[model samples]
Target: MADKSSNASKKSFKNIDDTQSYVHHLVWLDKNIENYTNQQKLNQWHELDDNIKLFSHEEECINYIQKQNDKNTESYIIFIISDSCSEQVIPKIHNCLCILAIFILTTNSENCQILNYPKIRATCLDTSDLFNRIRHCIYRDEASIGFSLLNKQDSTDAEPISLETKSNEQYPIRNLQEDQARFLWFYKCHNFMIELEDDDRQAKEEMISYFRIKYNKDKRILKPIDEFEKESLQDNAKNAIWWYSHNTIMFRSMNEALVSGHISTIYSYRYIIKLLCRQLKTLHKEYKKSISNNRLHLYRGQRLKLSLILLISNHINDLISLNSFVSTTLEEDVAKKFCLGRSKNNDEAVIFEIDIDLNSEQNIPFADIRDVSRYPEEEEILISIGSVFRIISVNFDEEKELYRIHLTLSQHEQLIVNKYIEQTFATEIDSDDQSILFGKLLFDMGEFEFAIKYFENRIRCLSDHNNHYRPTYLNNTGVCYNQIGDKDRALKYYKKASDIYKETKNQRGLGACYHNIASYYYDKGDYDTALRWALKALNERQQYQLEKASTLDLLGCIHLAQRDAEAARNNLQEALRIRVKYLSQLNTNHPDIGISYFNLGKLDSKLSSLIDAQNNYSRAEQIFRHNYPKTHPLITEVTQCLEQIKRQL
Candidate 1:
């Protein structure tokens, strides 16, 4: 039996490479794993880590650990072996670099302890003791918060982005800095959570169903899930903080999903997220009225990787946003103890000293949750997710052997972001629905894949095929496909939207679809077909000035392709006049206006008006450079045109 088990283990771990995505893995090897009927014992094991992988053979487990080492992945493995195979398996996997610790599950732990394997951290005869020891190891090794830094220079240099559909493209160009884009995306998501409306019973049932499927075998978690479902029949929002503070399935799953940025998981857990935020807001209001201090200081301690420490050190004056709900304390010693705890070799202990100004009119909320907390003695202060703070200073505490980072609540960074959001969305795509707004924001940020998924989800939820927003969703999905270079799929969705618009007599939707079709034909070099669609779009869009301008721009491009310089010039100039007059009222540097200037420059060059061409090209270059990255295609093309005109002069 032992030899057969060893052979099965070797063959089973051929696919061990799939576990690379996990930062920490738990591997349990017991020959009787299939026959193990101890539900309570299994529940205790799962509490240590929900994603435990069970194996019935020792050889397979050893191969899995060796494979992890071979890949040199940045992950640690906790290995648990039954007594029957412990002596043989420990000697094989103990030397593997990825193995963090080894546990011997035995009937006689005292006898096993005499083996003296340096990697063996514990010899456990019972599950409770084993759970405690493993929990400590996991916490000590992986105690950190997820955060992203926005350099001060990057934010200061970021110009207002223009969300104009450029010529020969189906969607608008986006060039926001990467960090700024993520920050705004999450901020929008937070707002969406607050505004989302769903039946509490339905949302809670959905959440419970999801976890029940995940932990079908573990009764420890299932019991709480059942209790939560029963308690949710009452006032769930009032107890949201208690559930969040308690180390249960809700707390673990939500935090893990938030830190990993798993969109699907977060959506499944939205009910709890919304509940927690709403409760926190109410508490924040009352807490503000009760406090008399003009300023308050808070501290949080954790171990971070050296790479993250260096990143924070290098960007001292920049902005940082915590990606999850942050827990801090008013007592410095409590926080200090957390940092001073055991940490991995590549980690450094750090304490975050956060200052809050009570007088400032900041939108982000934080509250003392002692009254509603699961552990009130801890005196926890919970800061809402997506909170932005400025890194005031960072210093090393020589005597304490740790680093101290100073952060202060600031809305200056958010103010800059607000301008960009207003300019990008407020003037265009005017929709009050938060879901639509968030989907469009993702599309504008060049997150085509995410945008596609979001639109599809929205479409599925809509019951009416002729719903007012159906055409919009279909058209946006098509545009996302086009951006990703899928022309056939793009055209299919465009035609679907066109059919819906025609049936519903939504003139505006029909006009947008016609413009998209024209753009598609224009890209294919079908000048006559492109002209026909552009004219149809113009007829439908006459009442909408910006939409009319877009159609005229398409007409000018088609005429230019047909070698009618005189006709192209007429159309281009008309388009330019309308765009300048309308867009100046909103943003002077709108990219649609820049697109007009570039098209006119091409027309002037064809007409041999060199000086006129130079002026138009120069204007286009200025706008493109300000609103886009230096390497953007528009900037590159305009720069090349200027160099040619200069040489001719």
Candidate 2:
């Protein structure tokens, strides 16, 4: 007799629990879920994922799945259904994007009679079989990679912008399309992980400690965690790929973090990520030497959501970057099995046909890891994270009933990314420190929370009390806090930074601190205090034209608040003159120039100079629209102001 308790435990769920960070959920839907045997099984399932939700009613389960789908969270569902409820529940939730795979539990497998639903991955009569199938489904879903599409419409030319060229400087590298910016950001993150250095013992201990806390409830995974801790201490880098090949906590956590773009989680797994990349890079060099063919073909098949397929289809000839370390095979048939197994209505079967040129000088690291893999028969070729590939075509194979996306490994996008970073580093961000630059990059990308976390981590790592970069880091944290609307915390960090700058006698740093303090006060409508700080900033920033302009702009805003129109006009005009002269040499459409124009327009509007206000607002609108996204607040605000100006005229 089979144990009904163990069998029921194999069931999975769909809905995500807010408290848990699970990428895969197991949803068990059975009416008799509260029965003694099933209740025991539910306890066992809880070991797998404590967030698992057991629903006795099919409608309740359906509603929960629907709600989760509407949330569009980064998680997938493996649903377990009893034969009685399969017909009622599967139909309603099978089409949900969150549904990864479905398993039907039946007392009699032969008479299951479930419809041929694409999500119906298996029909199991026994506990052991059901358990194995559910595990397999979860692993397969984990193998399904996430990618970002870079449409040609969103792409810029690959030609490197010369800082020396006055014409090129007028269009700064920072003015990148959303897709291009994301691609470069990922590239930079990959590099940061690979190049980051830390005490191996301490990093390993921290990683293991995190794993223990995460998987403490799951008894099955505890042994593997211990084994990894011992094994990693011996030689982690050499066995990195081997460990990753197994369906262990390391692989699961790393993949989940990467796919979701969870920066802090990824940072925690930096030790393992660095190990894997280093091993792959070494194998890549060796594999290159041994290969006789200059060209190679690879394949990876998985079910992609309809939206993703449409994105890829629309962006043919543009670039695509895999978010996680991708696994591909030389055997197309093996690859096809993954996608062709079951396709939910919301997602389509996709087989990626990749062409690689071994002779290309510009290539991201990828290597055949057969010898190093736990499952060597899979003949897996692991591509490093953030590898760029140009989409050749997207075609449907009528007979196979699947879409085939053709891609060629390309270096053009990488070159463009390098140029953008180089230009930004040389001109805008005056920092040689990679950590500071990375934090600044995150800030520029409008990832305020991540930037704050990153800067905080850097601060924690600093041993020198009087480090010159300390004030800058503190100020950067303050800036991020201000952006996120944490006014109190933002002001606290600014004051901390101000104290450091005074002690270091760093004039440039002091100027930035003063300006930020003034801006904070100005935001609070304290014009008197704002003016005092602005004057101090202006004095300290006299040698730095760009910094001086910013201080003047703040002073102008303060004077306007004080109702001193003459003072406001003088300050605003001087600020505008400085901004136009400096910014025109490096992107006249810069957001700073837009700020100046907008402020001047506000002053003009106050004085009842409708014509001057209209002209200033129009210039500000043009610049804001050119620089920011259409949905950006600045664009909407300026558009509203322009409408008001038109009504007044």
Candidate 3:
């Protein structure tokens, strides 16, 4: 076998668990993807090796390589960046796509203005620079830790993220000229580490086996899609509703709400890749069974195992590659190679579970293993979406080198919505729409602080186009603030939204602004002010049948709180009608259905409809418990209320 030690010790390959080589991050690039695409004009990658080095500051390194090396056999790539590019001007991945853009030149230069791409500071990073840096331990090779996207990319207008917990004690910066001889380096290595649990493997095998059987056993041949059974119909929002006085079945439809981002939202289910990974081992057992029965060739099991490995690896590779730039790791490929620095006989790093404390000293031993037996007990074991880092412990090598130590964020927070006022008035689409979407996800995930930053990023991007987007951004900002209990900021934004709306003939915008402002006032116990705004918004929304759900719901709550029993009943009934009709098309088990039911139950209880309230409450409780964690506070509260109500009965 090849001396694994020597090859591994040289280390720093592109596809390692701890380190990634090709991780490209274009911060705030999501905001202006079009600008980058246009500026980079990705059609000239092959012809511009020299130009590529200019942005990465690797011109000197490339020159050094060409001069010193005899034949230049190293088939490595160097990236070139543009000096004028900002986050809005740079593409997110400085990779093959960026390179291919130049060669592909899909659009004519005359039509260039038609495409808007986010851009990055185009520079070059050469293999020579990377190699020498690995030898010397110089961090000049490290990408400058830029401020948050809120700071205008063209100028340094940013609040640098603060590190609440410091990373590990700082080592003295290293000199690049001096070889690895000067630094005490620890080499790393990696191997494919299995993670599939027995039960998980079984489930996967069952799923696949079921599919295979369905595919092969007495197969009804594939039929054309156009030939179908008689179409079925249901009493759904998609269907027409007939209205009558006594036996009226109302079907109110919701406009299909785009989950904001063009990207599909990952929900509680549909984690296909993860699901398959979990069940691979079960198929392994089946593989053995087939082999023993003399019905399977040796290669068959190997093929399946290989497929499983490749599948798992590809998923991980994707995660690493996509997140590499943002995580400040070399792209995933480079990070993967970081593991090769160790021996095959050495401890193989199965995983890397790290909480990067963006600020304070954190001991991120560059290498780790999946020593599940020796794992630390932490509050939450966080394995991110990209790169399932298996910490490979116990690979100590004196000759190993640290190519670069990156300065990156250790923590994340979600920012609550604010500044709906800004959103309403803003005319141009935000350059950082992706970040805004990410922020929304964080909000949905309850990472309020992080969400706030994303929305703020969108808000800042709208500064230039404030006249058009100001209302919506401001409104969103206000909503975020309200969620986080920042009443002052929320009110400020809501008022701004109101002012912006007054400039428009849009009653919908006006109503939304008034309603949220009323909510803020109500939350603060400013009953009179709350009532005035709510009534105003309600009266306006009463004109538009399309968006009456929110208005009615808010009105119902307002009336219920004020003990206006008759008004509350009417509003709640209307809101419930809207909600039920809208939800009818969804699966009965959907969590939102439970929320609507719970709200209806609350209204019923307030009106002393004990049996009706009890039934709705029971439905709500089942859905909530099934969809949410047992420890969820909402679940606990609902359970407690239900018990109390039952005791009253």
User: Per-candidate RMSD vs. true structure?
Assistant: 12.0, 12.6, 25.0
Off by over 4 Å in 1: 1-143, 153-178, 199-216, 229-234, 262-265, 412-417, 427-430, 485-505, 565-649
| lDDT of each residue in 328-388, candidate 2, tens digit only | 9998876765664333334567789999988778458999999998667567899988777
Q: Candidate 1: lDDT of 218?
A: 81
Pick the winner on TM-score between candidates 1 and 3.
1
Worst 10 residues of 2 by lDDT: 168-177
Stretches off by above 4 angstroms in model 2 are 1-138, 152-183, 199-206, 231-234, 289-294, 305-311, 357-363, 399-401, 411-422, 427-430, 464-466, 486-489, 562-649
Per-residue CA lDDT of candidate 1, range 1-649, in tens?
Answer: 1222222223222212211122567888999986542676666666666678888877787787788788877667888888888877788877676777777888886667557665576677876556656765565345345575655433334443333333433111122343354455566666676676644565688899999889999887788678778884456888999877665678677876776654556767888888888889889999889889999899997766444455566566767778778889998776764554233444556789999999988677799999998557557889987787888866666577677888988773453444445565553543766777777766655567878987887788788744677778888899888877886788888899999889988888899899989888888888899899999999999998888988898899899999988789889999999998987666665667888999999988888899999999988876654454344456778989999999998
**What are the lDDT scores of the predictions, listed in order?**
0.72, 0.73, 0.36
For model 1, what is the alpha-carbon lDDT of residue 225? 76
The best candidate by lDDT is 2
RMSD of candidate 3 to true structure, Å: 25.0
Give the alpha carbon lDDT tens digit for every residue of 42-127 in model 3: 33221223223222223343343344233332222322232333222323333222221111121233324443432211112432
lDDT score for residue 545 of model 3: 46
